[model samples]
Target: ENNEVVYELLADMGWTGDSIDLDSWLPVYCKARYGGCPAAMDSAWQQFRETVYSSLYSYPRFTWQTVVPDTRRISKLDVSDSFLQGVELFLSCADSLESSPLYVNDAIEYASYYLAAKADDCYKRALKEDSLGNRVAAMQQLDRSVEILLDVDKLLASHPLYRLEEWVDMARDWGKTDLEKDAYEANAKRLITTWGGFQEDYAARFWSGLIKDYYIPRMKLYFSEQRADLDRWEENWIKAPWHNTSTSFEDPLQSAIKLVERYKGE
Candidate 1:
């Protein structure tokens, strides 16, 4: 039963069936290491952690405590500045669109929402201590996430899914006699204006709500150490003159951090 439960948990976490049965004793392991379990299932997880630690750290010089660094020094995520900037950019554009505005405006508004959501997600990830790093890196990743969201948003807004003729036809249908004359005019005008403004608005957004509840508090391990910035970082990393034979000096963590930084830079 213990083995089965362990296997099931692992499978749920995306582990293949080939791994060991470490689930049943997890809570015990947790208690021994982390003091206690918040829930019944955690008991098994605690035990499993101990088992793995014992197996992996049995060497004379190995120390489990040292391997997983004492997390006491880990500070709370300080993504306020970067997150604020991202949210500001995201919401400023998002809040301006009226509902049923021109199709182009709608597209731009939708893209803005998408970008904001992504930025929020990145900020939350940066706050996760288990997955977080130095302040600079965290800020950088947050910025990068926003920039990508904005760029892609604008790109999507500019290249609308439908052509101008299709949009005009749609506006006409919505502007029929049943609709108020003012309503028709307003809707038609909005649609037309949006056709041009979509490119300008790109990823516009409404105001951002407060920054609380943006990230998971306890489950920090799910956050990423890699920079969220892909385009610029990849360009630099791949094209660097010194990247030829120095795998030892290749810092994936730093590269990821740099990407996030560059994202904020723009």
Candidate 2:
């Protein structure tokens, strides 16, 4: 119902199921949200710029459209009506351990994309309002965008299957006993790291402070700034430190292993 409400809001805001190019919109969004904070804006701008560049080498071209949720498919599966049916199907396939990995992996991908789509929709609305000079409306939409993203994070965290440790355990118990804990952790880390290479291009956001410390404050600055101060804002934002754009880095497998060990201790 909550998701439905959000979708309705997006529809009312003129979302037409079309793809939005994050490469173009992200800079604008970041400027609106973080323009006042030089440090924040620079960090965000660098990440966004790198993400766009990295997508050139990534297969299928990572873009907002690529991750947008298939509302048609989601609509077909009425969760309330099909809950029992889904449980029954799961029970029926309980013995099929071979397919467990496939199912779990697919679920992760689906959830990530769905959340990305929701966030993107909110972003588009925010952009529209900003363009129309509706500062308050734009701020509201931006806040909604971050709220939806944080909610998705919470939802994923609440689901056992979405947790890395749980996923590893499930795979290990399902006839992959040979899968070492370190290897499993490394694989999970790689999945997240790769997806996050393009500035959370695949909904790999893990930080909870993003909204409170960065996004909201930036939007506030944007709303507070006068038209005459826009040039100074841009100048300050551009002067912030620029991080390296290259994302061709190896996964921190050892760190992932340590994380797994700590999770086990907990």
For every candidate in turn, the CA RMSD to the true structure comes to 23.2, 21.5
lDDT of 2 at 207: 27
Task: Mark the 10 consecutive residues where model 2 has the least summed lDDT.
Answer: 242-251
Q: Report RMSD for candidate 2.
A: 21.5
lDDT of each: 0.34, 0.38
lDDT of 1 by residue, 1-266 (tens): 11233454555568455554555445444344334434422432343334322332211110110112233333222233444343333223322322223322333433333344455556554455225557666556555554544343333333334223333345446644744433543454333222233231111123211011011111122233433443333233222221111011132222222334454433
- Number of the predicted model whose lDDT against the real structure is largest: 2
- Which candidate gets the maximum TM-score versus the true structure? 2
Model 1 Cα displacement at 6 (Å)?
46
Over the stretch 1-266, how does candidate 2's per-residue lDDT look in tens digits? Answer: 21222253355458556765654544454334323223333343344334322332223311222222333222122122122222222222223321344333323323333444445556667767888999789878767666655544443443334443344344344444444544554454334433344443243333222222323333445555564564454334323322212121032222222222332211
lDDT of 2: 0.38
Q: What is the lDDT of residue 38 in candidate 2?
A: 32
| Alpha-carbon lDDT of model 1 | 0.34
